[model samples]
Target: NATFGMGAISITSEREKDVDFTLGVMTTGVNLLISKPKIMDSIFQFMEPFSLNLWMAIVGASVGVSILYFVLDYPSEERKFSARETWWFSVGTLLMRGTDFAPRPSSQRILTAGFLFFVLITVSSYTANMAAFLTTNNLEKQIQSLEELVERSDFQCGTVKDSATMNFFKTSSKPIYRKVWSKMSEGGLVSGSKEGRERVRAGGYAFIFDYMINSYSELTSCETKMVGTPFRLQEHGIAMKQGASIKSILNINLLKIKESPIMTQLQTKWWENKRKCDFIESQPTVEFGIKHMAGVFIVGAGGLVCAILFFLSKKWFVAVRTKEKSAESDTGLEETLYTTDKTMSKEDIANAVKV
Candidate 1:
């Protein structure tokens, strides 16, 4: 008696008496595997990772923060840091190559810290996600689901010949299954899983197979990925003669192995790891919008408004002080002129009385 290799022996109710199967080693389901699309050619495609609003917000932030920095630490009537130097500092922080223009006051230093934090997070996210966008292909149409597979007429799908997966479609009462079986009966059958996937790679075709094998192919070398949710959930077990004496012992051992870390080790060796590929995949990427980064923009806008208020308040105080100085000088000059007039009148009166 022989147990199946890997996860090939699917446990079925009909074979329970004749074949004494061990507890399932693994579970898998049916799914379709398709090739990754080639990269599409387009203009300004590199900027796709972040939405247009996000890009504009980033630009606005750079300018706003620079202006805020200039207003905060700048001398009222002289130059501590030039506007040109402040701008370079802003750009340098984003480029991750900070300049020598450091802020002097608490407010200016806090502005620098907030901006540096924003730049650190934003730039890291951009560089990390940029690869996915750069390698993107314009896939305007894709059969992402089984219902889509049924509806689309442009391509045909196939499976291994007389396999349990095919039998399932044949026996299923659902119209979609019946229709799929009908299409397969005509010309969609292949001799084995490998040939089925080969037909998939030849283009204008899709292959439905057990998810475990196809999933491994997707990770490693096939440039293939599973589309849609898996169906026909089933377990693969070790098959043996119905009354084999070692069945109970074997079942016990299998359970022990499943309960231990050995199961995880095997899965990691075979499935969890990905082999290096020449091209990186573009999928599973995030498209950053204003919402994802709203906090950064809000903080920057608030800083700009605060800086403007500070500037206006400084101007008002300076104007008030200048008015006070001018008023005191005018008062002193008026008093001196009045005293001179009084002295001249007294001298004239004395001269008249003496005559």
Candidate 2:
């Protein structure tokens, strides 16, 4: 017999029992590759970027700020703004329309600024987020996890027949892997790794292959990606039959290469080719939570508080001035009465005093 040992041989427990293997040179794992499809959305697709709570917040903020504006402007002497006018002003501002009836009160101004700032942030982020979702094609739903893949009836999977990947699925004690193997029995078994990849490329098929190739394939095909995390982590080594004399020699040389700087250089030669592809995964479709826009919310709340404070202070100042004027008028009237009493008799003073 001839020595049949080289790279690309997956080192596994079953294989190790029959043959000795050299130190692993390449590390890889099994993963599923599926084609990306365009997902159709409802008429309200524009709302996908932000959560429902966020939409409600936007509406609540707008209505709440407008009502507050009316409350502050109702009693103002400087502006003759009605409830209808105030509401229309708020709507115009939110819609990015120009309006001449800007609030004159200091507090109303602060509230408006805050509302405008929130609108600016929301509109800009919404535009960017919507664009990313539309372009990324992440809206297309497929089996995103192993459990989902197992339950998926529309998609089928397979691996290279009699290959290490196939063996792993076949011998795995995990119910999940066993179920996968059972499905493969129905069809999707390919003669070679290349054939398996081809079936995956045809669409509606998931191919169990090396994650290294999975990654490279994603780079070349922008519409494809790994369904879930890579499973069955393993290594490729020189596989040899039992009692091979060159085992020691092969192990020593492979270990040396693995430890030395040449390993890095060699890996670069294989993976770092002068090529690139467009990527959409991990780009958009990521949900924007409240924390992302906390600053905007904070600014708006601060403005609202400041506005309320200014409104209260203005009312207090006006009250104080009115009280002082009333007191001065009473004093003046009393002095005039006293002068009348001095100039006229008790009878004339009685008529003026009106007991």
Backbone clashes per model, in order?
A: 0, 0
Segments of candidate 1 deviating more than 4 angstroms: 1-7, 40-139, 277-355
Q: In model 2, which runs have C-alpha deviations exceeding 4 angstroms?
A: 1-31, 34-40, 137-163, 166-284, 343-355
Worst 10 residues of 1 by lDDT: 276-285
> lDDT value for candidate 2?
0.79
Tens-digit lDDT track of model 1 for 1-355: 2643334767877667677787888888989987765444558767877989899888888887787777776564443667887788888887889886576665566677668778877887787668756555333467887677777777788888878888888888998888887777778899998887777777667788898888877777545667888889999987777677777887799889988999888888877766445445444345788888888767755655655665667677878989998777665655655576665554454454344
Q: Candidate 2 on 1-355: residue-level lDDT in tens?
A: 6696574678888798988887787788988888765344569877888888788777788788889999998787889677787788877887789587888988899899888898888888888888877776454355777677778888888888888888888888999999999888689788976777677767788888888777777766655777788888888888778888888998888888878989788656665562265544443365566777778888888889989998898899989999999878766766688776687765665455554
Distance from true location, Cα of 103 in model 2, Å: 1.6
Candidate 1 matches the true fold with a TM-score of: 0.50
Return the TM-score for each candidate structure.
0.50, 0.53
Best model per TM-score: 2
